[model samples]
Target chain A: MAQLTYREAIARGIAQEMRRDESVVFLGEDIAAAGGVFKGTVGLLEEFGPVRVRDTPISEQAILGAAMGAAMTGLRPIAEIMFADFFAVCWDIVVNEIAKSRYMTNGQMTFPLVIRSGNGGGLRFGAQHSQSVENWAMMVPGLKVVVPSTPLDVIGLMAASIRDNDPVIFLEEKALYATKGEVPDGDVVDTLGSAKVLRQGSNATLIALGNMVPRAQLAAEELASAGIDCTVVDVRSLVPLDTQTILREVSATGRMFTVEENPRLCGWGGELASIVADEIFYDLDGPIVRITTPHIPLPAADALEDLAIPSVTRIVETVQKSMNS
Target chain B: MSLDVVAPLLLDDKLDLYRSQFALRQFEKRAYDLFLENYVKGTSHLSIGQEAIAAGVARAMRPDDWTFATYRGHAHTLARGVPMAPVFAELMGRANGLMAGKGGSMHLTSVEHGVMGSYAIIGAHLPIACGAAWSAQYRGTDQVAVCFFGDGSTNIGAFHEALNFAAIWKLPVIFFCENNLWMEYTRTTEVTAVANPAADRASAYGLESIIVDGNDADEVYAVTAACVARARAGEGPSMIEAKTYRHGGHSRADPGKYRPDEEVAEWLAKDPIPRYHQRLLAEGASEAQLVEIERAVNEAVDVATEEAKAGAVPGEDLLMKDVWANGGAEWRN
Candidate 1:
């Protein structure tokens, strides 16, 4: 296994898909030549050339529309929204057009496209740029939402998304770009809707996604020091949710906590919590706790932003206090 | 003045264009009757007076060339030679409809017919056309993408974005704007900033200011044909604004009470069907030849209406299919 940062993993994943299929084209603002604003796609344009690795004008609708049109007409395209928050300008294309195309066409036009965007808060890009809006796509019926926390997942889930004959919203956590993880050399393919049990325990089950996954693991480790022994699950794909893994783990632990970067109202966790209550209500020991950011616009100040988003300390305290209660 | 070139169409071509337009007129007329009879459910935006543009543009396009149309797309779909029965069945919401009853009249799509999709959202399909053209460019294919939208869509962000993007990339695509006088209830002239929404804006993107008499199929054909040829030859994108009118209100619900009777009569006088018939007759087409096409089209439309009226509503099993490639809407398994 080779150590790769989350940023490097994005390039590797896209490159792997593009290499595999000539039809797999990547486009976004600053993704080509300039190597993307985040530098995640640093070497793509050099390797794939301008035709395959395009740097579109600052038109989110155009980029996604092009990606959708390409996907429907036989190209497996990977498009980036620069920031996940910018989906506001082009939500019509994302939710209405791209998502509904396959179903509306009755399987005549399939959109095997991956819309990659950097999501969640960390670098104080303010409320407009910092909101974790994967749920925006999740609520839409025809879309597949994927949030990868680590390097390996970035590569694997991206491939799965590209190959999958549907529009996949792949949100890369902005905070996790610099984080490193061991990824196996050669093709690293993984299945969508499958959660990884990074750490196993019996006291409680802590499920997280994107930026919240790393924090959940840290919180789990800290709580273990106090004899809590919580399980950490990276609930990777939100659409095809790994309910079996989460339900089994939650049932075994008899407690559940959701660590989410998005605000509290109608987050993916709420949907999952409702499902857990409906299916595994008898199995639960206590209330399913959702440790999420407050239902407010994310603050910009470094201190306030850190406090607003659920951190390791917050997760640890929330889980510990809930477990004790 | 139109950007009409001197490429004269053959007598057979004029008859074919006449047939295409006559069929569309008959289809829209029938569709309105069905709406009154409560057969076409929900809402529909008919392209009654805009037949010439869709027919002309579709005629100019190669069979493999892609077509992206808007909510007012019944004419465009029919123009691409998608059989009338399925389209009518789709309007009536039947299991054997063009999209199996999933997409209603506004969202008619037939990939096999090269009719990519008819987007309900205004100006949304413009960029999508660019994408299809981009794919063709990437694959080094000679297919051009023709996108149809309304004068109202010119003000939207996607239209400008698509124009600029297509121009820069020089993608084989044509942005066909049907300036049909009104933007729903409001006159398009009042809401729009310039005299010509698409043509005036074309210069901004370094494209030619090409406009045609949208009621004249021959003019629309010549201009769009040149644009298609330009795109196929890798000369970049073209913006063709077809000046036209809508015979009815924006949709089935609206009575079009906003327009004065005289103005409506004036445009109706310029109705593409009669004008094209006159042109075809003037171009050495026999009266018998035109009458035969009219007769054939009327019969086909009546048959389609009957077939559509008899079509069964889609089964419940269809609901659980095609949301994903697995033919299931299962978020979790």
Candidate 2:
């Protein structure tokens, strides 16, 4: 067994696929000789060489359009947008081109590509650089959205996305890069639409994704000491949502809550809440609560930003008070 | 290739060029007539007078090569050797359409014919063409990607990005611009910074500046052949500007009222089909030979129209069929 940081897992995950398949290529800004700005792809250039691991220009449209063309023509390409917020610069390619090509062409063209970007608030990167844009991708019909909460989940989900035939948006939690977790001895490949129940309880179910998963787990642990037993479920993928696991967990406890980092309006939580209410409305104790950031631009100031995002104390208190009512 | 001269072209080659332009001309006229009859539900863009570029370019390329077209793509689709029925059915929203009516007139795709797609958005296909060439380069293949766009595409950001990317990476791509004078209602020169959109920008990307008379089939063929050969030989990319004009308005809805009648008569006099027909007669090509080819092309259009008219509008089954590779649009268990 070995301990691997989330950043290390990203390179390993990409390297794992590049080793297995010659057609799997990687391209992005500052990713080749520079070892990536985030340093997640440090050794890929050395291993795969310059041909397979390419460094692109500041042209986001070129990077994505190239990936799309390559994917359509018998190659699996992974393009990086550098930051999730930059998706706005190339949303047409991602949504209009990549997402709808398969459907529009009547399955005549298939896109086996992965678009990876650093997501979420922390480290005070400001509003322009930091955004959890998984919801932006999830709202599209053809894209598969995946956000990894753990280091091992990174490798597993990355491998799954590269193998899947559709375009997958892999969002890496920016703050979780330095955090380390155990890496088992052999290869690890996970499913895209599966949710994991980290901690089980009978009182209620707390479903969270990406950066909010760890915070929700910590909140669940702290609340356990206060006699409020809550189940923490990590939603790994959003598009092919694991409604079975989510609804089952929420149904067993007859309560549900979503801890989201995206803005309140049109976040992944809002969609899940609607689904939960539609499917299992009678199997609830109280109204489903969504612990999320307010609908505003995230602050760059460290203290204010920390207060804006839902913290463990806030999650625990919100769940405790809601359960009591 | 001399200007408006076919001395270097063989008699059979001249006949083939005539057939290509004639087929496209007859097909477009029929499409416009169908729109008048209320058969075509949405809009269609007809490249009536721009047949020389399509004819010469498609004739010059290898059948295995890929083509990326724009929304004004009915000419490009037929140029790739796709039967007229599927394309017409696609425009008419029929079940037997090119994409099973999933993609209407603007997004016709025929992978079997190497017509990758007909992108509706302007300038989007330039980089995608670069990507296709990138794959061909990666796979160690000699296939070159030929991207066709209007003059308006030159001003888009993707156009600049793709040109720079193609130049830096030396990808095998040929960017062909059909300067049909009018980019939708306005003249291209009124809004453009440079007079020659595609050719003038070639210096910025370290490529040669080339422009040709698009009305001359022999001229476009010679230039396109050289560019394709250069791409296949791994000589990076070539940007070509073909100066042509659209005989009709931009799309089916437009009557082209903004154009002065004198300007319209000047272009209509230089219609590529009749000009090529006259050229074929002078090049030792018999009038009977061309008359038979035109007859065959007209018959082909007539047969395609009958078949497309016989098709049904796609049902709900096709509506949800192609959302994923698994042939289902289901997002959940």
Candidate 3:
């Protein structure tokens, strides 16, 4: 095992896949030469050359449509949409074309394509650049939504998403790009729709997705100091949700707390809360607690942005309130 | 304007084009009747008067070349050699349909025949066609990709992006626009600024573009052949706008009252099938041979329709099938 940053791990995962399969190619804005604005595609252009590492124009519609076409015609294309917010410009291609092509073709076509985008708000990039739209993607039936928190998880999930026969929306948290963790040296492939228990506790269950996983972990540590043990679960693949694992964890703890960066209304946290209420309501000793961003656009100013987003302190307070109730 | 130099066509080639066009017409006519009889559910955009474009383009393309078409793609698929039985079965939503009753009329695809897919979205397939062409070039193959869209598609962003990309990369692709002069109920003039969409934009993309009489199968075939040759020769992409008209409504329901009667009458006078038939007779082809071809086409359509009616409707289990090629792990029961 070797230590790698989240950005490096993602690039390595793509490089490994491209080496293994010649059909794998990268298409995005400034992904080539500039090595991606986030440096997620560093060293890829030099190794793969221009054909495999393509720099497309600022046309998300064309980028996604071309990727769909290439995938249908025997090429594994990995398209980067730069930021999750930019998907608004090409929403039709994603919802209507890429998401529906497999079902519409009735198994006649296979879209082995991956769309990687920077998601979430922590750097104060303003409303347009900072938004976690995983919930919107989860609403679509034919797509697999993946969000990895750690470097190791990103590596494994990136490899698995590339190998998947269907379209995958891979969301990389912009803030977590520089975060460092130990990634296994060889090929590390994780199954989609599987959840990982990052910390073990029995007092309460803290389920988090993407960047929220680390915050939940910190909250769990704080709760442990306060004599309230908490278990932290990383909801890696949101679409094919690891519901069984979540149910088991929630049943064991008898209390559930969900965390996400998206707005509180109709967010992924709501889905988790509803599932717990429907499946394991009797086991819960207290009401389900959700720590999420309020229903307001993220501001450019640091103070207002921090206030709107869910913080570790907020998670701890929510957990304490649930414990008291 | 008609071609100054008419390309020479052998008797066999002329007969083949005529037979294909006849088969397409018979198939579409029967499909319309089936829709009326309630055997084929859902509305279909029929390409009755645009048979020449489909037949000519499909004929010009090699078997290995890929084709991406729009919603009105029955004729395109037929011309590409997809069996009539599967086509009808698909329209009838039977198990023996082209996509096993999954992709009905608008989404017919035959990977074996190199018909990649027929997109329901007007301009969505343009970028995809460029990708397929790029894939062929990346894989070091001379195979070209042909994309068929309507005049309205030119106004979309994807159309410009695809043309620009194909031109810059020098990808082997042919953008064939069937300018039927109507985007559903609206005339092309109302929406688009240019008179000739394809030719007007070709210079902007630094690619060659041509305009052809879409009703003339021979002319369309000749124009497509030249574009195909240019792509195969590594001369990059070319656009061919075939100016034709739809004889019926955009879909099954509309009466197409929006179009002027005089305009419709003028186009009706240039009906491709009869004009080609007359041309064949003028070229000393016997009338008996033409009759024999028509008889064969009619018989084929009848057999296909019967077989499709007899085919089984897809069961409930198929509802969850084909969501993923590897069987979606998330949706597995």
TM-score of chain B of 2: 0.96
Runs in model 3 lying further than 4 Å from the true structure: B1-8
Top DockQ hit: 1
Q: Supply DockQ values for each candidate.
A: 0.85, 0.84, 0.62
* Residue-level lDDT tens digits of model 2 in A1-325: 8999999999999999999999999999999999989999999999999999999999999999999999999999999889999999888888889899999989999999999999999879989987889889988999899999999999999999999998999999998999999989677899999999999999989999988999999999999999999999999999788989999999999888899998888988888889889989999888899999988899999998998888999999999999998
For residue B240, model 3's alpha carbon misses the true position, in angstroms, by 0.9
**Per-prediction interface RMSD in Å:** 0.7, 0.8, 1.9
For model 3, residues B47-132, the per-residue Cα lDDT tens digits are 99999999988888889999999989999998999999999999999988988788889988998899999999879889889888
Report residue A27 deviation for candidate 1 (angstroms): 0.7
lDDT of each: 0.91, 0.91, 0.89
- DockQ value of candidate 1: 0.85
The ten-residue window of minimal lDDT in model 3 chain A covers A100-109
- Candidate ranking under DockQ, highest first, comes to 1, 2, 3
> Against the true chain A, what TM-score does chain A of candidate 2 give?
0.99
| Models ranked on lDDT | 1, 2, 3
lDDT of 1 by residue, A51-96 (tens): 8998889999999999988988889999999999999999999988
